[model samples]
Target: MSRPLTATINLAALRANYLLAKRLHGGKVLAIVKANAYGHGAARCAQALAEVADGFGVAAIEEAIQLREAGIRQPILLLEGWFEASELPLIERYDLWTAMHSLSQVADIEAATLSRPLTVWAKIDSGMHRLGIAPSDFPELHARLEATGKVGKIVAMTHFARADELDCDTTPRQSACFMAAIAGLKVETSLCNSGGILAWPDLHGDWGRAGVMLYGGTAADRQLPDWPQAVMNLDSRIMAVRELSAGEPIGYGGGFVTERPTRVGVVACGYADGYPRVVPSDTPVLIDGQRGRIIGRVSMDMLTVDLTEHPHAGVGTAVRLWGEGLPAAEIAASAGTIDYELFCNVKRARFEYQG
Candidate 1:
């Protein structure tokens, strides 16, 4: 028998999440399929959302090409844009949208000969100070891209720095800075990502980038118009059952000592399977539909769970790492991380997609 470890991806939940973004943000949503749709299988997720999403956003030309090859006909935006001048023609050939984040990109566009004018997003580094033109200089940069005549439909966009903090004023200040930068321009703006869409209802734009939220991550505060369903369910199974007396220790470094007589189920998954090893004992898991907590240090290929609460669970009992009955966010929070990292780190697990 094969290892029960698998990631079940529900495409319907994914589509519904995309629609939720549209309903909440009230605009065109570029469903972020970058990072392989945050490790939920990019082609499948993109195909599921192709009919509803206004467009799709990816990290680079390579990802854009991957989507195009997978039959994604909707407009795909190269969120990070071209890495070299050589990618310009390929960007044109793929009929993909590219972001103008730096002056070198602006220069590249000016020097390159393309088959036609390109739809470019003028990225403003409002406050993130990441990969965008400075807000103070964005208006002029917008004008410069326009003057190049090779550019068309420049969408002004900025990423929020602290939008996940519901009470933080950074997002608002960043929005103000971005608006001030493009105050006189008649360009359609994209200002909201998942965090902005969830926490700042009053703030939206003509185009909103829906990222991790669409994958049913974030929302740590439960701030949403509707409860978005998690699309991926990571599951594994018990390999052995241990009957240990009090004072018995589990896994490496004797991280967790058994309190009272205990039942431990050795699961066929561990850190190498993308489960965070630092998530101290008591990280949650679902065993045979019963809630249980991980016990002790996670190993490279296995982890142990306290099955004392679950008398009926034994070898081959279904164990859910997260999704559906168990939420990944809950586990992530326990690990001092975010669900995006958890979702993207999943590897070596057989993926099964369902509608």
Candidate 2:
């Protein structure tokens, strides 16, 4: 028999999430498929969302080109924009939209010779201090790009630094700065990410960039909309079962010691498969539809679960890592991380896609 480990990608769920973002924002959504659709397979996910999405956002030019080659007809935006002047021609050939984050990127566009004017998003660094021109520099940079005459329509945009934290005032402050920066400009604006779309209704504008939420992860402290569903169901099967008495140590470094007589079911999943090694023993997994706790340190290829209460479960019993009844958010919280890392780190598992 083949390995029982599999990461199932549900395209239907992905589409539903996209629609949820669209509905919530009441505007166009740029379905973010960067980092290989947060490791759900970009080509397939993009194809799944191509019909309804206003456009797609990717981290670099390569990602956009891949979608273009895949025959995705929707507009593809380079979220990070062109890295060098040489990429400008290819960006034009692919009919791609780009973000002008740095003055150097603007210069590249100005120097390039294109068959037609290109759509550009002037990214303002409201407070993230990571990318984009400073809020104070927006007017000067916008004027510079306009003088080039190569830009057809310029959209003002910024990324939120703390939209996920409802208690934080950073997002609101950033919005204020963004508004002030573009006060006199008539350009359309894009401000919301997944968190912004869900938490900051006032931040939604011409476009919403939906990322992790579209794959069934919560973006903020609030509850997820009912329409969004888990796009990835990561699961494996029990490979072995053993009985251990009290005081028996489990896994490397004797991380966990059996408190009583125990039935241990070894599952064919571990850190190498993207299950976080640091996840404590109390973390839960579903075995034979019964909740079980991981007993010790996760190994490279396997992890042991306490199955003392589920004697009926044995080899070949189904185990859910996270999905459906088990929310990834719960697992993420236990793992001292977030759902984004969990989704992106999945590796070596066979993938099955259902539309």
Question: What's the CA RMSD for each of the models?
Answer: 1.2, 1.1
Worst 10 contiguous positions by lDDT, candidate 2: 220-229
Backbone N/Cα/C clashes per model: 0, 0
Candidate 2 residues lying further than 4 Å off, grouped into runs, are 224-227
Across residues 1-355, which tens digit of lDDT does each residue of candidate 2 receive? 7788999999999999999899999999999999999989999999999889999999999899899989998999999887778988998999999888877677787778898999998899999999889888888888888899998999999999899999999999999999999989879999999999999998898989999989989798778548458899999999999899999999999979999999999999999999989889979999877788899899999999998999789899999999887888889999889999999999999999998
Which residue pairs in model 1 clash with each other? Answer: none
* lDDT of model 2, residue 249: 98
Which regions of candidate 1 are displaced past 4 Å? none
| Candidate 1 whole-model C-alpha lDDT, 0 to 1 | 0.89
Task: Evaluate model 2: give its lDDT.
Answer: 0.91
lDDT of 2 at 142: 85
Q: Which pairs of residues collide in model 2?
A: none
